[model samples]
Target: MSAREPLIVQREVKPLDFLAAGETASEFKELLKSLGIPTDICRRASIVTYEAEMNTVIHGGGGVMSLRLEDDAIIIVAEDQGPGIADLEKAMQEGYSTAPDFVREMGFGAGMGLPNIKKYSDKLEIDTRVGEGTTLRAYIFIKGQREE
Candidate 1:
């Protein structure tokens, strides 16, 4: 991780890969811990990572998840080539979910992904197209930089 290059960790997420679901989040959290980031921020980043990872797996058909540690914040980016979210507003609602029956049966998609992501991250941005794909960027500002 060169200062000029920035510290970024990227991982590929496979569709329906329940077995590997939370791995990226766990690894990212560990990385944060190793860097001595605040516990709360680490937890928040992990939450964002897991939600993004799950969404990529269940709906994205596969994509890339990356963690970029910046001078003032930790950024989590999830990008997928799967069908994009048709209704962005509805998907932001806590109980709205497009996950299949099997996914719900497995105790995964209870909706809440975007809602929780919005809650945890200080800032969130999403760029999506109907057939192209979706890219979500969530930022957790370091201490002293975040607003109350």
Candidate 2:
């Protein structure tokens, strides 16, 4: 196998699916812990994953979250078929939410999802097409070196 080939694993997040929601991110966090990743890095990764998963569940309509484990970093990719973000800039702002009132009632749609993800990820990129879909790629360096 190529050295660059990732050790790939993934999980699906479905809307209103209580049984499996957020499980993927949780498992990813545990895997990172087992691999001896630093506490801070692991926590950041876990938080990012959860936020991304919530976005997928609440906004994406449903999607898949994948983890690509590389020697130097862990990559998170969240892809969904939900309506693409209409305003990327607005969505990035803290406390800006498009989630319905019911989701907010659950104390989850505080509008911190993208902001928190960006804060914790070493690198963040988003690809979205309104009425088509959205994809988010987040990188977390595991080498104890934070990117400036």
Candidate 3:
């Protein structure tokens, strides 16, 4: 309850698990709501969670999603051990997805994952390496402190 103590929540993502993906996103939204987070912030967080979850499922081949609540910000971190992105620049572009045929056929990978995450989160950081995997950290400002 104090600024010195932060709350963290995490969930494991499975490769291509559509049902679990939805569940994880919903759980995050509900958790945020129960914590008295503003509805708008909750929505933004959920959108970011869903996009990051999808990327983990469809492209990362499984990973972990975590949410951290601090006194001034909400942080979401997604980590994966799958093959890393070769081109960060191209991956950030909208409509530029590396999803395979089946993933696209599932109506999920339109290459908007990173773009949507950026749109909803106040700040985003991506650390990626080919063949190594990636770690994405997204922050949403709260309590009117948004200079980061």
Candidate 4:
């Protein structure tokens, strides 16, 4: 199938589950392929999804990620109930992480999580409130028009 085909898949997952991260990534890849997403674009989408999932697990304390596949775009919404980000601008900067020491020991606390998500996604929107939670919505276009 090609990206022009009509196919959509959606899934909800709990945060911090051991299987949540890898499972979500694999499902996203399969869904993209099933929907006729090009291989290259699927790879990019998978990467972004994985990063978002990880954030939901490690930072959000727990949350849900929902994905929608459209003929020309992929939309992912990741929500979490952890401490909200204090500074969105600073968080978007590369190499600024707040991961705890344990996560750092796992070799993923370099603070590049949010930056990487922004880098791989075509459009990113984050909504967060202190002591409330956070929600991240990202969009990736399959055959979107480019401005001159």
Model 1 regions more than 4 Å off: 1-7, 145-148
Give the range of the ten consecutive residues with the poorest summed lDDT in model 4: 1-10
Window of ten residues with lowest summed lDDT in model 1 = 1-10
- Model 4, position 127: C-alpha lDDT score: 89
**Which residue segments of model 3 deviate by more than 4 Å?**
1-5, 145-148
lDDT of 1 by residue, 21-127 (tens): 67788899999999999888888899999999999999999899888877788899899998999999999999999999999999989998999999999989898
lDDT of 2 by residue, 28-98 (tens): 88888888888788788888888988899889988988877877888888889899999999999999999
Q: Over the full model, what C-alpha lDDT does candidate 3 score relative to the true structure?
A: 0.86
The RMSD (Cα, Å) of candidate 4 is 5.0
Q: lDDT per residue, candidate 3, 1-148, as tens digits?
A: 1123365688999898988877887899999999898888888888899999999998898999988886778988889998989999999999999999988898989999999998889889898888988898888987773431
Q: Scored by CA lDDT, what does every candidate get?
A: 0.88, 0.84, 0.86, 0.77
Candidate 3 has its poorest 10 consecutive residues by lDDT at 1-10
The better-scoring model by lDDT among 1 and 2 is: 1
Cα lDDT tens digits, model 4, 1-148, are 1223333554565655546687788888888888677877777778888888888888888777777666567877787788999988888888888888888887775888788887778888898998888988778888964331
